[model samples]
Target: MLTPTPTIEKPSNLVAFAFLLIAFLTGIASSFQLPTLSLFLTQEIQVSPAMVGYFYAINAIIGIGLSQILAKYSDKMIDRRKVILYCCVLAIGGCLVFAFNRNYYWLILLGTTLLGLGSSANPQSFALAREYADNTGKESVMFSTIMRTQISLAWIVGPPLSFSIALNWGFDWMYSIAGLAFLFCGLIAVTLLPKVPRKKMEQNTPLQAPSNNQKSVIYLFITVFMIFNCNGMYLINMPLYIIHELHLPAELAGTLMGTAAGLEIPIMLLGGYLTQYFSKKALIFTALWAGFLFYLGLLFFQNTWQLVLLQFFNAIFIGIIATLGMLYFQDLMPRQAGAATTLFSNAAKLSWLVAGPIAGWLAQFWHYNTVFYVSFLMIAIAMVCLMKVRTVN
Candidate 1:
């Protein structure tokens, strides 16, 4: 049954703007760390590719556990303001540690793990966004789209800035900048953000209960797992590919990552409105198909410009997934907002957990370019799995 759209008041512009600001600030800080992570591990620390994967896998593994626990607490008891503030503190401290102690592999791993644990902040932020939607009786999907757009905007700015800083000053300075951003985010959380409580919706509320069967749920999980598995592979290897394989400038890594993310900003902003005309299934399926093609193209690109152009396709796929994937999960498990969000979040984490070691091993044994073939295969399989999802309409 299609529930009538609620007539409840919408969140004030001020409230929505605050969430956007937080998302942008957090993105600015973390962008410095993530895009340059592999470069630091491989170039600065002189670690083997396999060891680099191990470090990332360890980080993802720890993040999976910590984010899940934090998600549960954010759903049930904890104030999200406290949770977000604590996460920023951990991330800031981790970045500072990495900046100073990166030469020590053990310390690097420790700092990365702390950063991973702080990842709970993202899901908690999503949970808070949902709570605001609930209070205003607005659709959670709308806020999710808006928040994603803002994050994309930050990515557009962050990557180039990070790359420039790394090129001119040093990678260490990049980490220092990221740490300060987190510190600023912590301050914003304390002063500007609200402390809204999670209220229980009545049974008759418009929120639909989860309706997917076990098989359907399994297929969605596999599809999400595959999507992020490809994501994990690319994140772990793209720097090496650009620097070592393509013989491009190291800073191009940030430029490419930033460019792709920038393209997503428009798509994310429009995604909610697009769904009004096209079915969500069509959007997701088309994105998956585009992803398959994008990865396939990666196997042939011989120049930096070709690779940069191909990232537009990649950005389209990621933007759609980021904006719509959670909404799809919520449609599947509509009763539990936190659980729905975390399911997708953990899918990415778990994929990173596996992909780090596996992608590293593949790149080591074969060619770095061959990793894209594997990613192509994963996307193809995900597309096949996505076809099996039963639509509510």
Candidate 2:
């Protein structure tokens, strides 16, 4: 039988609303860069696809180290607001640097590393939401759902806007807009955010070496790593595949990605309701099974319309996995919200770090279709690991 823990006090509705708004703005800033990044790297900057992977891998490596350090500090301080503030400032600077220095590969690499470190804001935001809910008697899972939904909504809007900007103003303008947005977000964070009390912020138990919880966290980390390995291959390679393999207009790639993210919004909202009826285990199983089938289709689908249609399935798999993966780790160690969320976020970054170079090498030498096969295998392995960990449901 599970023992119940006491809930912490919740922040005022206004504070919560502010957090959500900040989440949306940051999401927009981050998403706008995604649809056009590979295009800018290869077409405008004239870098090899393999080089794109290496650059991103380096970025993720920097993010892993910086985020780990920041998360630990937030947990100890019991205040994520400061970390979020720092991230926003970094985002603003990095985006501007990336915007102006696109021609120099070394500069671009440095800017991307800073942006990667800044993106740790995503996990910190989730942790803050959890802490707020604990204090307010709100559901942590539901807040997570809402937070993720806001990001999904941003994905829907950001991509189309990014595509239009790239088409009209030039790709540099996309980074410029993102930089301004990040600056605005930083101002909001500094002026409006509240602080958690020392007592409320501290972990329930006294400081000690990690318990058995660390073991399960490790297992879950591997699970998340594999899930995102599949994601890295797709996000980094799909635009290139569509442009090079299918010979489609570059704008369609953004449309396809945006459409999929749009479809994900409802799924994310539905996740809150689903948890009331279906077990987390059941939902995660559904997602992995859907993913397995979707990646399998990637090997066969050649037509643009077919790939577009596949986005619906991809949206479902991605939405569920992203939402549940965070909640699962938080559930694993409820007290260390900062550490848990950061670990889960790092799992994805770490996967990208590894997958980037590997996927690039495969696509460079072998074939684009080969990436899908590897992704499918990764998803299958994640499913096997999920089956073994009965604690999740």
Candidate 3:
């Protein structure tokens, strides 16, 4: 009996590089909308706070439920590129709706749903990277490196561009620009991505089964959930805390938040390199502990400058946590790339969905400071759990 010769895979550097560029652009466009969209809804559309919260919650709920379905469907489909192309189109349409519509509730709901679909690009991007890596015999660390680089690039470019556009041309132009960006990404997706052939089932293949110890993945998911809850709490409540609790002016609040975002870029860039020397588990635990300390410092923050300084540290810690956590999770499930990415993404969304309302209620009743304390406690707990995690390698 003759042994079957193994099929050799060819390298596609052009394909891999193009996918990374697209991912970077997609992230930049998405981040541009983050700082201003809520304000636009509340101030321009005259939507109530409660309604804004509800809209965000609904977006999270839909995204979390739909992500796995989309991932599984993409796995079954012959062409993953088509799924990505359609998602980009939906994002563009969502942007158009928000840009043009005067019906506040309808527009907000449609736009949020579109944002959810657009956000789907995140996992899909990782899936694409994983496919490329598997085909070319590249290490999984390269995928994490690409993701961190893209995220850092997006953070550096997005805020200033959005702020400038909003300042000169108004929020309408911002939405229009975001829509154009999405359309551009859609076009790139359709033009650049080749059809990837579906994999055939084989006996004793690495991709055939889940790894024996998946509980580590579960712990990583829990840690991601905790970190994201802290993130969501900060995003939802930070401005209010600065304005209402700290009595800072609106311009100052905006400036501080922008500065925090700017600080994240360097930290994230450093994270890509640091993960090489440091244990992923140690990096994550340290980030959580540092974030907890920053949150605790918020209690004693006296002046605007103190809060600003804390935010800088907060950004650094959060940046490290996000990058390392993602790398760790991706390594844990080298086979189920789409499912793993979807699971981690959904865990973050789940954190936000649960954290948002509770943070709002805590602010309403106790105080914003109380919310921070609760967040700090959660991070502390997460750090403990993360310390218990054993590295998969």
Candidate 4:
């Protein structure tokens, strides 16, 4: 049941589209928090900058643990829809807490725990989509790639809309609406998604010895972790830099994020098209260069138009790695798609576990723009690590 092989007849087209909608809704719901949480911490909750970073670090830590544990047991369950439904419900509750509460203790103990568990929805949705393709005997890799685009699609509008609502009405209104997205997402999962029957449980195989490429894969994971930590720090620091340091209006931050997300879809498609002509290492190096350029722009170009233009580089820098990194792990562990994808997801969260506190301290001690400087240095480290691994396809 845990394997990628088909276990049942193909699901209906309606079921397929339902998975697509779930992916988008889950993303939009999650996206509302991604760009706005730091702002909420500073403006609504009145926390210190370091606490904002620590908040994310703690949340990511819990989220990684919960997502992995849930993913571990999902295939063992009779119906994974139950797991998705439970995660969605937890997300809704977390949003409500944000809507009404300001106590940091309650927010940390209860709020982060709920949202942390809620992080499981994303991987579970992809897992279901992968299962959708596998059981139907459709092409799974392309299917999973397309499924990921639903998230990019969501972010194109989600951040701008979330910030707009927060700016005009208040944080509470923004969060209440976000809760509704999760409500609809959960309803769709329990009502619209399929409950495919599972194969009889197979005996667990003993874990094999480390493969020859395990060392290289370990290096790749380390490099990817470092790279994403920069992104995690950027996400926490960027809005504050724009609003407090630059004295720019709050809405511009959302638009900047929206601009990058708008370009990510097309760039991902184009990169996928070009893979036959370029080695994955070559493209990854190109992305790292684009990342360096992006952070450099953030350092020097503080104006609105120039910053907006920089998102073109941002899209290329982030879009390729997000998709390819997962594929890279899948290639390294072909038999364990479940484990591979979960590891990819955990790498993202695990990065944040470290990134948040560092970003907070940097902003507190030096200046907000210093976070960009450190972000620039992170790309150099990533590029160096990339060179140590042998070339990948």
Task: Indicate the residue-level lDDT of 89 in model 4.
Answer: 90
Candidate 3 residue pairs in clash (backbone atoms < 3 Å): none
Better of 1 and 4 by lDDT: 4
Looking at model 1, the pairs that clash are none
The residue ranges of model 1 lying beyond 4 angstroms of the native Cα positions read: 1-11, 42-49, 102-110, 166-173, 200-217, 235-255, 299-306, 390-393
Q: lDDT values of the candidates?
A: 0.74, 0.76, 0.71, 0.77
RMSD of each: 5.5, 5.0, 4.9, 3.9
* lDDT against true structure, model 3: 0.71
Question: How do the candidates rank by lDDT, highest first?
Answer: 4, 2, 1, 3
TM-score of predicted model 3? 0.85
Between prediction 3 and prediction 4, the one with superior TM-score is 3
Candidate 2 residue runs with Cα over 4 Å from true position: 1-12, 39-50, 102-110, 170-172, 198-210, 240-252, 300-305, 390-393
Taking the tens digit of each residue's C-alpha lDDT, what string does model 2 give over 1-393?
Answer: 111222223246766677778788888987788657777788778888667766666667787888887777777765567788788878877887877786656555678767876777777778877876776667777778888888888888887788789889987788889988877776766655555544653655543225765666776778789988887788778878878887888777777777878888888778767998887767877888888878877778877788888887888788887888888888777667777888888898788777777777898898766788898788878887776554644
User: What is the number of backbone collisions in each predicted candidate, taken in the order shown?
Assistant: 0, 5, 0, 0
Summing lDDT over every window of 10 consecutive residues in candidate 3, give the lowest-scoring window.
1-10
* Model 1, CA-based lDDT: 0.74
Highest TM-score scorer: 2
In order of appearance, the predictions have TM-scores of 0.82, 0.86, 0.85, 0.83
Candidate with more favorable, higher TM-score: 2 or 4:
2
* Model 3 per-residue lDDT tens digits across residues 70-161: 76666655556677777788888877777778686676567777777776776777776666566657665645565656766676678778
